[model samples]
Target: MAQHAAVDDLVKLLTKANYDLTLVQHRLDKEFQQIYPHNANPLKLVSRIKKIQEDLSSLKEECRELLAAKQDLIDKARTTLVGNRSLLKRMQASSGLPLISDSDDLAYTNLNQIINEWTVQVRPKTGDGKHDSDSEDINQLLFSAIVQNS
Candidate 1:
């Protein structure tokens, strides 16, 4: 039937678009990596939002290492961390289609913000320069965000 042929054409068109979209995503990732080499590119961060959320949820807030740190750092981290839950939900709503789209500026901004805050040094605490072992988890998380070739 003509309708079946039309549907086949639509699927083929969408497949081509999706392929083109991936190439664009990689190009964007390379550009962003230059500016944010230490942090995960925002697009990759958004793509991995679920994995990050799971890692965040499993953190032991009561770890002695975290408790001794300045309160402000903890406070700000808490505020930023809460927003990721909603981001994960938004990604879920998109289901099979790529989450990256022209209309996702807010989500992209939020994800970039999260990546910024998690970068190695949030602030300079006035104390011995040594850092706690538990806090290193966050450092590793950020480092892992970088693309392997980057």
Candidate 2:
């Protein structure tokens, strides 16, 4: 679950790297110039410096991609959570139950338990003459659900 640096963290890192690269660039130029007067062997080290720069560029791009993916996941999760809450509210209304508070409790709540509670509220009492049709309809729905699941 460990993620790469956040936007501000990356900014801070880039700031430090920029300063360090400035110093390193100046020193490398001075040293390379001093060495070049004696021989041409330092060209191999130039490739090494360029390699470091290329690696740094690749790393920055990777960090940016990771951050965007993390943000996209967060956006998707927020949308799903909001839709679930709306559905829960509608279920409460239909069941004639008091609405659960929109709070942290929802995170801990068992979805199955809430569904069972709603069914209990809506189900007709046993042996009640007035609700026989409603009871039959509920039974049919339950049977259909079981068949579908199978």
Question: Number of the top candidate by TM-score?
Answer: 2
Please write out the lDDT profile of model 2 over residues 63-116, one tens digit for every residue.
Answer: 555544544554465568768888988999999999877554556255435545
Pairs in clash, predicted candidate 1: none
Residue pairs clashing, model 2: none
Best by lDDT: 2
- Assess every candidate by TM-score: 0.33, 0.39
Candidate 1's residue-wise lDDT over 1-150, tens digit each?
999999999999999999999999888888999978767778777768978777665553334234335334654665675576557658767775445453476755675576456433422331354444454544333333432224
Question: Where is model 2 more than 4 Å wrong at Cα?
Answer: 1-46, 104-150
Please estimate how well model 1 matches the true structure, expressed as its whole-model Cα lDDT. Answer: 0.59
Tell me the number of clashing residue pairs for each predicted model: 0, 0
Give lDDT per model, in order. 0.59, 0.61
